[model samples]
Target: MNPLDPAGIFISFEGGDGVGKSTQSRLLGEWLREVTGRVVVWTREPGGTDLGRVLRQEVLHGDDMDPRTEALLYAADRAHHVATVVRPALERGDVVITDRYLDSSVAYQAGGRSLAADEVERLSLWAVEDLLPHLTILLDLDPTVGAARLTDAPDRLERAGDEFHLRTRQAFLDRSAQDPARWLVLDASGTQEDIHDAIRAAVVTRLGDALGVADGASLGEREVG
Candidate 1:
């Protein structure tokens, strides 16, 4: 897959809610900034930009809509996000790690909501002008287990029935299997630090040459420049 930026990395975290995408995104952002000496932008789909925030609230907490409508709304959010937030940051040679991206839309809208999978994917690609993450980390976990971890009121996707979530989970796995090079699948059942370690190791490989490009040298005990 062609990277969005050769020097500026793009990464996305995906999983069912409470699978630790937020926690791990935070960790990865901090690590990339500290280790690679690059400005790391931590953002999320359907909520990364100001417009996305409104779309996110309406999609997740507002009234229900048909699958196609839902899918289009997410695509609109992503289009604006990539145009305003993600692309600009990457153009500046920054590492952009998003909590969720196109995959969530495909999985939830297509798999969970029973729309055509390829159509859902196509819609998103069209929205973002085919911007794909350089690397996407999928925190694999049982949907029920992930649900149990959530303490607050569930959102629209989380409130979706178990069968819907199961289908969504399978969609994520299927997508990851189809593109192993673009994805790193880790069991989310592990401890947070353990999962983070695995994610960091995978990212380090991609950043093998990027470290030199971003920092002018390999990372060392030296302070981040």
Candidate 2:
């Protein structure tokens, strides 16, 4: 079964650092399990598979590297992750929710590091075999505010400075704008509850049939809101 088939729903969360993507991903996974009783495969990029764990550590903590090297490493991890984890789960008709996906590569590498966006996009699409999410929830936040929200020591990507993050944020928005039907852009500055509500609404709208929920039924009534 192809992961992109209608039998499964693929959702990815994207945003700048400190944009609460992790929280939202977790919340949605729990909601789907409780309300819809469907298997939810919660995962992340560069760390979703065993190989991805080592690549993630190196990419995040290793010494500085060339932009092309960094992009290739990320692409490698993505390829492994999709093949070993994401694709199999989706092929089983599960809901695959990833914290980050190919868009992160496009925004961080191409937009932030001044690489050719189209080139980076092509590389990633080739790596993933053009597997895109059914819905991408983009948490839009100002880079300044996002930076301030980071309480821990900055990682290599995080320490790349404000200009890089601003460009990355714009790239996410631009991609979302280009494919409005496939993206749900929300303000990350909003309350967490509010953001999760919006995300849930979007997911329910798109995956109601797969989730086994009637189109007009109240998902909130089935689970803790």
Candidate 3:
């Protein structure tokens, strides 16, 4: 049975570093609030809750560890995040827009680190009690281009090298292809406005009935930064 709350909509934005996921997630959350008049919970993985915050710092800055250890720490953070923040928000009938979800674990831990993809996926699903996003918008971009867009110092994962990022990107594409209905693969090279428009359209299409809006109804134009 589906674990997600029937009254809530869950959307996740996923992409490599500097691919504009944070910007897009914020814009989408704002648009959803305006259109649906429902509470929108905008959050991110590995730092969405109190426990997650500490785990995020350690995982991103601490000494290098075994790939399995890193994956387990991420799963632990995800378990706490979903149980405390995401699941409760969904139970309250809110729209939850997360910056990353289980797919990120599969991509980064499994693909980037060369671990078993199925194992990584299984660990994440178990951590979240089988919860899954209603929609996953993947901003696909060339790793080189994405790296160039990052203005900050490299984090542990960001400095994992081009080959790792390439594998991660391919993993995302492969997963999207395997589940096309729940995934919207968008090119990250597009203008911000254009990308936001496409994302908005996808969200509207999926949740229009729940939001009491007709298909293709315009949600009004607004600048998204």
Candidate 4:
């Protein structure tokens, strides 16, 4: 793929359970297409491709698996996702937006499960091979609030409880704080319109040139220094 196109930005949406990631991702994807006229490919982690979706079901629904084993499953799904979906889309100069990525694993499994963060990061680096998203938007919300939005009984991970979600939330915050330039925290408590507005603003401010024209200032050209 040529490196000159400015349409190769990958933006990821992240947060704890029921933090409105799905809703915001849809809204943002639609808005980007309407405003920027760039083809947008939207997908979710652990389930972007066929193999990834199967692995996602295993990891999310199957019986108890060790943290390391579960983490490996997630990494596998991510690898396939990046290879089949994300990489191809970006090579075609499409804006690929994913619902979650390595950060979710680091927060949920490593941070919440008490596994080593360094280990998770190391494994993720191997899985993604340095294809980090140009921007990660983390929707910050209270664990209780986010969990309550789920109508059905909790899944294995969701049943991990409020404390687990709290830890995951903190993990996300810590990561965003650590990498201020790459991550943006949007409050997920208010109206959907408000949340969408904030997200749009962040995208425009962070990826101004990439939104419309093909300039060197686009995300494809500028590496996160």
Best by TM-score: 3
Kindly report which residue stretches of model 4 are placed more than 4 angstroms away from their true locations once superposed: 1-6, 213-225
| Decreasing lDDT order of the candidates | 3, 2, 1, 4
RMSD of each: 2.8, 2.7, 3.2, 5.2
Model 4 RMSD to the real structure? 5.2
Provide the TM-score for each candidate, comma-separated. 0.93, 0.94, 0.96, 0.91
Candidate 4 lands at a TM-score of 0.91
Q: Write the per-residue lDDT of candidate 1 for residues 1-225, one digit (tens) a residue.
A: 454767678899999988999999998888777766778999998899889999999999999988888999999999999999999988898999999999999989988887999999989999988889889999999999999999999998889889999999999999999999889999999999888878877776765466543323222422334
Which scores greater on TM-score, model 1 or model 3?
3
Candidate 2 backbone collisions, by pair: none
Q: For residues 1-225, could you state the per-residue lDDT of candidate 4 as single tens digits?
A: 223235588899999988899999988888777666679999998899989878977888889888999999999999889888898888888888899999999999888997999899889878988678889999999989988899877778998877888888999999999989999998899999899878877887888676653333322233232
lDDT comparing candidate 1 with the true structure: 0.87
Clashes of each: 0, 0, 0, 0
Ranking by TM-score: 3, 2, 1, 4
Better of 2 and 3 by lDDT: 3
Q: Scored by CA lDDT, what does every candidate get?
A: 0.87, 0.89, 0.90, 0.85
Off by over 4 Å in 2: 1-3, 216-225
lDDT of each residue in 25-103, candidate 3, tens digit only:
9998888788677899999998999889899998998789899999999999999999998999999999999999999
Expressed as tens digits, the lDDT of each residue in 1-225 for candidate 2 is 223967778999999999999999999998888777779999999799889999999999999999999999999999999888888888888899999999999999998997999999999998989999988999999999988888989989999988899899999999999999888999999999988888887777887766776555454545323
Worst 10 residues of 2 by lDDT: 216-225
Q: In model 4, which range of ten residues has the least summed lDDT?
A: 216-225
